[model samples]
Target: MPPRTEAHAEQQPAAVAVGKATPAAEVEPPGKVQVTVGGAEEAGSEGEDDDDDFDWGAAKHIFVLSNAGKPVFSLSGDEQRLSTLMSLIQGMLSLCADCDNGDEMESISAGSRRFVFLKRGNLVLVGVSSSLVETASGDEGGEGGEGTGKEEDEAAAAAAAPECESFMRLQLEYLYASILFLLTSKVQGIFLKSPGYDLRGLLGGADTSLRGIIELAEPSRGRGRMLAGGVETVWMDPAIRSRVARNLQAAQTASAPSGALYAVWLCGEKLVALAQPRAPSHHLSSRDLLLLVNYVATQPALRNAESWTPVCFPRFQKTGYLYAYIGFLEDPPSSTLPRPPPQGNADQNSPPAQHSDATAGTGSIADENEGRRGGSASADGGTQSNGSGSRSIERDSGTEAGGAAGDSCVILVSVESSSEQFQAFRRTRSALESRFRSALGTHWDRYLGSGAELEREGILTKFCTQMKALHFHYCLRGKQGGAPCVTQCLSSPFVDHELASNPAAQHRVWGYYTRAALRVRRGSCQEGRVFCRRRFEGNNGYFGGGGGDGRGSGSPAEEGNGASEEELATALFESDPVHSLAYEVGDEHTVVSLFGKRDGGAGGGGRWVSSSSAGTGRLGGGDELHVCFPSSVSPEDAYKAAVRLTAIVRRDRDWLFLTGTGAAK
Candidate 1:
């Protein structure tokens, strides 16, 4: 990866120094490896007699060696001795195999021991294990069970050995991917060119992380990250999920000039939201995004501050690296603080190409760095303290958020190069934090809220208002196999005044519609979570306040009663599942439903459930507005509705969950 441009240097909040690595030649002899670095045994090394460490019940040792046959890592034992072993292994492989043309020497067996080799561009991984795999049948025979026939035993052995080898190969791939994630493909080359470079220094405090990954890779445990090859996404209420995703999408647009190719928010290692532009013919794959997340979580420099690093996402482009800017945004206070005016001098010197409309009147990235630097230099930095109590530039510039610092969240922005739009990234990060805090408010903690609370409350109505713009009516049911569901109907408030004025008279019409939605759910909600009914033929006479089926009729209850069974039965559509997109909209109970519509009407008709019923009303006909949405409404409008509804519903639920211990009101 190329070095940061001068503009980038000016905008960096703090620079981490990279010292020249000392030559490796002075410390060791060829074919002789010492495990100690700086005259002390490395912390994670296993001693020679560490036989008890074989609780894996197999040879769990692995070693890394330089091309010169110097030891870099070992599963156990002293370094000096391990270097000799590495050299011996290399010699044996070279003598027996023809690798001069660069084809790697893979696996070899000597009696009961087998050695496996996996080579990257300049590094090599070697695994030492027993050649024979003990299968279930083998164990049975050894345990004094009736001995199996010789043919069966041999077949089992053959099957088990290959599986073991495959498993070993997977471990090696994980090991290599993790290292690449840490040092990056760019820095790996730097290590090789220096020859004397000690990879341990580059590893820093990452040994524990790597060890944990290895332990997690054991077959007794879950699948390794390589096996999944994608991000482990967190499950969130669909309403919240849509809000978070849409916010990121908007931020990406605002930060475009900063060279942002994509933006993602991760709650630790689990992906919460990912945003990228729609125009680009290319986008990051889930697998590549997961790798990026792994690197951010494992690398101290990236996690600790607003740092930029050059990274090569092998899946995106193999020839070069991209610049990634990573930082953690601490949650805002309980009360929203009035934002300070945008500072002028902070970014007056930014490059012309990096300027953006989203940041037209705001401080530049340089200003952010200045604030951070000044705050840190002073003993009592006052407002400059980062929300987490660390000194921050935003505080210094009066752009710090309100309230005491809260939980910190990560924000990652990647641009193709430093020269792209450095200023835009800073602006986008600031805007995203502000928007997220505003939308989620005090309940913004990703881990907050339980599944049961969301279910009983029927909160999907609070955030599923966007479906109205799409002319979608949805029912979000409870978890019980056969229990009542809180169904929400929505249409734009901008409707025919006649329909809006007299909801009761339209009750029979709405009831018939409700039956359609219910029948769809009744038939299939048990088998699958979502169902959608579509009518492509123009109108089909279902819109004139009449029952489509011409049987049941429902009227608004006389005052205080729940929905009539007849009204409850009229679901949106009743057909074989056509198109369905379901999203978990709450921590537990609610899933936002996405239903499609095809209406050839004057105003693009829609409907919405009003907030009159807190989702528990008997005959819960809380003012349903069925209207024709303005034709100009687009997907962006739906996104905006989702954002607004998420904020309102989340705040409402926070209070509802806290107060409701009694029977439904």
Candidate 2:
């Protein structure tokens, strides 16, 4: 039987009456109890209550509409039901254009809420955020304290507004890019030709993907990759990754007329390997790659069965579409397959073990069987017991081995679609799958296991003692004259006791990092300069006072003499130790470092000297390095720690980045 497609699944009734069940009577006369229909009393009441209780004012809202005031999509609430609000937004935009002498409406601030408008051809996208810190009212302050305090507050508020709006605009751009990715940029022309056209119809059911993109855009989710505009690669053994890449290349070469332009392998959200055309210009851009990853991840139906869909890489070529063949590698059926007998108990009738060195003389049973069977095992392949113990051997035509049931590994191949070309490509896909499986041995079970080993050997653990932050994100841009690539690494302690016990501290730490990232990307911050900001001094203190005196040793009293409140605050800001820092190193690189609260007062005093040569000299001119440090660590110590971390990353660049030739050498 063919696999059920999403549309077919959706068309099936949610419930069926197996045994001639009848609906209960709607009402009973007088004192008789009323009969509930379908045995669902207040069936959707909880959902209704959830919708009613939802804090719409607090959550971010994204809306897409036509110039003719037709609603297309809304991140929150139903777009069709929100027609009045959409119409008002359209009218407001029209007023802005009419009153401003044809100028476009970019943003509008009303108290704490800000609305950002982005117009693309005949469509309009508006993003609304209520999370902005409200500007303090001047009337609240006494007459004597009004001047400098209010001015400073106003300046800070002004700085924050633009940053929030800029990020909102970026979110809208991603939303619009997602639309263009689904239906090429020609969508604009479609709307231009017919102003009253309903775009939602053309979008089919892509709103789910757009909603996912919005969720990822949230500060607490997606992390630095969303902010840095890069893709996060799966961490694997360099040798294994290289072998996978080489096999992908070999597969492409085997099917010479396959028309396969690019092949990508993904283990969940992280990329395992990618093989693009030798031509540098044909590579996928980071933005397009991110969108593609999001699409695959958001759509559960894609995971259910292999799919051939048309996808457009807007950054690659907005005018054209590429046919993508996406298939998930199935795990070998170990239960039904014959297992070799235990060591020392092998039956006399079993064939003698033969060494198989088809690829690199690994002597694996799967490889040996494939060789003996002339590269094509029979329907019922032979099983040989090795001295080690009972082990399952995969047949030549069976599914690939390794990975848990829940684990997902997908292979995506893209090519220009054509009747003859697609048929040829289908055959190539089979050959590629076979070769891909043959390249990976049973060792995948060891490497792709629980991932504890990966975390232990990862950069986070390597420098956990030195850089004591809760989270870290690193991006390594491709070297000069190579294909544009951005390799990313993100780590956070999943087993940290303090973070697990104190949820607020976790939220605060991420907030600090998010704000620092915004500051780094803001236009006001000059390039090649390190940006540092102190964490907020709340009652719970950093890390919920898990260890040590949460406050640092560099207190205002130690600085000598009587100090004013402002002086003390400044001293605390400089010495109390914050969790995040941002340093923009030219146009193509950035380093955002974060720190957690200290454990046992580890870091101490050091002078912070701002140097003009800090970015180029101290940072080692790398792509991006984001780390976390203890809150008790002084700013100067954090800076020095970041420099040390950069040196360590530079030394291991080969293992960290996936470069032009293939996996990192």
Candidate 3:
């Protein structure tokens, strides 16, 4: 987004630079060795040594520790060695509380680094980041005062500090939520019983989950999912989506427990379908869905077998645990295996057939373990244990011939765990798989097999062709039965290939949109705003803009103070066009449109393309569309393309979004 501040420039080296070797005379013999957590480098034998070696001030660092000063998890360094730092953090909070009549410290700013603190139950979460506030000195007017330029700049920085701190706060909140997802709020009881309890011992295998959340929360990697608080969805045909939903609904009705809340179907990273309770208030939130998906994607163990885990959806109910029965319906395709045969019309009355080859090929540890445990299938479609006297059903292979290959289909059901309903639930899960596979038939292979590729070649291709846009991300927000729901879509190439080689450029582009979105939400762009840099005549104007260069007609400030919405619309609709335009349409929508050419191209010059369009719109309204267009495309042309895209979305809105009760489509 904005250029790195002076602080980032100064501290960046510490984050990436390797440490110099100490001489034998200077270096002391190794003391009691501390094991590194999550494969991170040891933070050193002593706190002072750790501080000297670790660049805590450089990259973002997250710490979850007990109020008793016990380190739980450290994102960057060894928590055991960082125990001293954890104690210092606790001391600061205690000092703040004692001094401010129990008012805790929320955030602390030290030069370019900012530390934000959050307390949940007996635990304290801390986030330290070098990310600083955008100065905006070139655009925002300086308040009238008899102060030096440095003083004014400092004041501006102080005023903008809250924005960066808020982001850090959000990161900490997500981190805490992830902990709750794993341990539930009941973790508070453990802390209450034993304040010095080592939470790390309990969270032993959750390193990947915690790290995945952190990575996704990072601005550069997540690409606005955390900022927008929404999940990316897989775009599919309305009819097929409807069928998928119907099957999920049937499964939920036939098999789900009375305590069932929601049943979600996911293919890879994108949500495919969801079946929630009739009460819209009971629906799962986009934020929870995003977290759940990320957690699943990160945990390879989950892919190998069915799991019964206690997951907390903070938005739904933060106080307790919801039992999630997560199972993969199909194994992700591999190059070595032949594609599984389509669903067969086997007689329902026939005995269940065993597919040992499919189970072996899929490499399910649970199946092998169960086989060793003397687990056997009963006549009633449930597994009976001969040794432990426990009951569990073997997850349906969902194939008559061999292991299914393509996108892995994950079915996650959230319900209250009960011993009596457990067996029935397992049986229901098997039946649901049968019903779902039967409904999709050959289309299952076609869609899950090559759905992503098809999307790139299908509607997305058509839209990009007409709009001349390089990438697009759209999140539609609305209320269903008074609960907020969101549907989102991202261009295929945007996530995978386009600009893949140039991460800095991609970050810059996304950063522009994110900042513009924040500004629009804050009502700062009432008269519209333009963010562009005039460098080398239309060379990546949006990304390359704002930095002062003595080449353009007007100062950066003058260019930023763009025309009013009405005037800008007139200019775009008519003849005159601008490089960047940001305006809000009433309270419900905000649009930020940018046009620019990449810096490097085939002939020493690049074609300007419409880059980004972000806004909220009412369902079925043309104004609800968010799109990106090529720089060559005029505003009018972009508008027309948006209209076309809107129509397509409108026609498929039911399937596109997880709306009301059964089969929203």
lDDT of every predicted structure (CA atoms): 0.38, 0.49, 0.49
- Candidate 3 residue-wise lDDT, 625-648, digit = tens: 345444455656655555445444
For every candidate structure, what is the RMSD over all alpha carbons to the true structure, in angstroms? 25.0, 20.3, 17.7
TM-score of 1: 0.45
Candidate 1 residue 11 C-alpha distance from true site, Å: 62
- lDDT at position 47, candidate 1: 35
lDDT per residue for candidate 2 within 452-476, as digits (tens), equals: 2353344345344434543455555
Candidate 1, residue 394: the lDDT equals 33
- Return the TM-score for each candidate structure: 0.45, 0.64, 0.62
The alpha-carbon lDDT assigned to residue 50 of candidate 1 equals 37
Residue-pair clashes per candidate, as listed? 42, 7, 9
* Cα lDDT of model 1 by residue, 315-337, tens digit: 35534667766666654443344
Put the candidates in TM-score order, highest first: 2, 3, 1
Which wins on TM-score, candidate 1 or candidate 3?
3
| lDDT of prediction 2 | 0.49
Worst 10 residues of 2 by lDDT: 11-20
